[model samples]
Target: MGALEPNAALERLYRETGWTMRQLAQEINRVGTERGTPLKYQQPSVTQWLNGQLPKESARPVILEAFARRLLRPITHSEAGFPAPRRGSTPQPPTLDGLVDLGRQDMDPSRRGVLGVGLFSVALTIPGWPDAVGRMDAMRTDPKRRVGQAEIQSVKDMTDRLSDLDDDFGGRYARPMAAAFLVNTVAPYLKATASSETRKSMISAASLLCYLTGWMAVDEGAHGRAQEYYVKSLELAGASGDRMTYCHVLRGMSVQAANLGHGAPAVRLANAAAEASPDSGARMRAFMAGQQAHAYALAGEKTNALNSLREAERAVNQAESQGRRFGGFSSATLAYATAEVRHALGDPKGSVESLHDHFRLRDSTDRQRSKLIFSSLLAERQLQIGHLEAACTTWNTILDEYPAIHSGRIDGQVRRIPSLLSPYRSNPLARQIYERSRELSAK
Candidate 1:
């Protein structure tokens, strides 16, 4: 073979990023770690790639993602000097059929491990509300089966029950069951014959369930998988002319991005959600603004972040005066959002205070999963502020309920408890927490 040619396309993009080869490699490694795969690529690896070396197939996505996050835009194979993927380019399936396929994969035991490793991409292409609205083609109805209002209500009721289960236990225990329901029940309903109004209502109901499934996936840390479900939810919501659900899914996507530390994408998605619903009710407005505030804080836009927080607070107060409640968005939720914003803005003390307010505001109806998560956050911040004993006390409360929950995110928090208290292991409380963490982790 002739000598390899220089990759001019990659070289140009590399220059645009203004990153040293080592920095580029480090970013790639970081992305790998986020995807549950630790990589040790060094400057030499990046040097080879710029000099015409092809990255391993698995590394290609990681490399593209690193550049995408830095450039704040999608980076395609051609744009990055990489060849098209060798896999066959199949046409996209119809909406309902695609949902079935996605749900089946999610439910299958063998494919789940593979799904967990799918990388969350900051450069994912999100369809605008106008573009997605009425985008689905006419479905080939299953004339043998018909659905109506009663069926639609059943779907909604089932989704609510599954959501409750997910809250009381955790996504690890609830997601597969949700996926199974989506595949076995919801998919068939989408294809069943019905009047246009009934069909649209059913689609709207299905979209909400899809969103719930995606939220569960996020709790499990299957972020890329969650994005897939979120996109499908958006499409279904749009096809049904359910604008609110579409915006809700977008905000969930933003939450996933924020959790993954992809601040730019998070902010972009949060803004998109708010823009999509101009005349949203006060309660709905608060829901969107709180997430937007979290996103802006993560993006390091202090002014925009503070502005959104104030808007959320005002909206919440307005909503209360009007006696309107929108799902789980309330003062407690705002306090949690405030804590996230403060934490991101380097105000650990303020964040801790907000968290205290959150717990004080929370009632029995709050999701157990969230209680554990926020409590974990409170403990960590307490530890950060030189309140070791207080942190241990908070952690003890978490441990009392930790083994009962099975969320990947919460599991991660528990896994860290031992190390977090290791430095102060000589202290009785710290040692007790550390020992208990090891004991639970072993199980």
Candidate 2:
């Protein structure tokens, strides 16, 4: 059969009823389950419907039932623009046009609930379209400009707040907040008429915002977008002559690479960070070294990992000797980075030690959240080394604090706990921890 015509009847019903793709899918799934004809539909399937694709024989009845529920009016197969059932056909992936159509229908200003649902549903599945890297490279070749003290201070304040938000709530909320700041605060200043000095500072600030946005994208599993943002940020940092910001961006790139199993590239990026900021304060040196150690560990270079870890320790010590007045790094941040390296190197005891140090230095507001993450990490490491009871105990602690911490990072850590405890799933303690985590997530 030729491609089915756009289903104007279904489209009008969906629009008049103010139904989101997700809500429609959920209602379909619910009805199917109740009638003993269970159906499985992912977000992508809803996307297909919104695109006007005729549902296959198997999906048609359920879609009709779902729209009936949504519109509170009976819908028949003929009314939904379907012919008699025919079986056996391959399914196509949802298209961007389909998603956009659904978004337009659900984003109507007159429907409050539908609008909220549409925004979240669409945001969750938004594709990361890559930008041309050559543009950034061209900008980098442009003449460098000087930046002023006033703009520098403003950038500093914004960066500090962004960092605090990341640490507090992880990357979920941080991404949108950073994006707003970039569009509203940094981007305007970068394009504004200013002296050479002000322009340079504005560029520096904009580059940092780009880096932050990229880091947030990585956290949300949008690696392609993250890479694009990182490249752009690196180009901007080069033009601004901000070696410190360059180091931060490189460090971020290393983390992304390591997470994606590109260990060698991660190690190279970490080394570049250290080399670019050799004269930076002790804390900065330690942070770079800590990243290097983690990268080496991921690359299976045990000796290099150990050496880098020791170097990081030394850098932290030197930073402490500088009267605890390091400009960029704090004791707590250094300790957290050190703990991550130790955890990567299979040193559970050392990881816990460093984590304890981090706790001691962390501000009161961060204690509950950081502790939840550190505890989860500790539990995973324990399970790796066959410390079942210890792992269970740590996991229990994480579960207890999880309700108060809504960080995406912490949620990831929690999700990993079940697999780590798979061997002990039959054990009462392990099952208890797992059940509690499930319950917390349900809430």
The local distance difference test score of each candidate is 0.87, 0.63
lDDT of 1 by residue, 397-418 (tens): 9999998997989999999999
Q: Which stretches of candidate 1 lie over 4 Å from their true place?
A: 1-93, 109-111
User: Top TM-score: which candidate number?
Assistant: 1
- How well is each residue in 122-209 modelled by candidate 2, as lDDT tens digits? 1112111122111222211111223357766887788878777766666555666676566445543453456665666777777787
Q: What is the lDDT of residue 323 in candidate 1?
A: 81
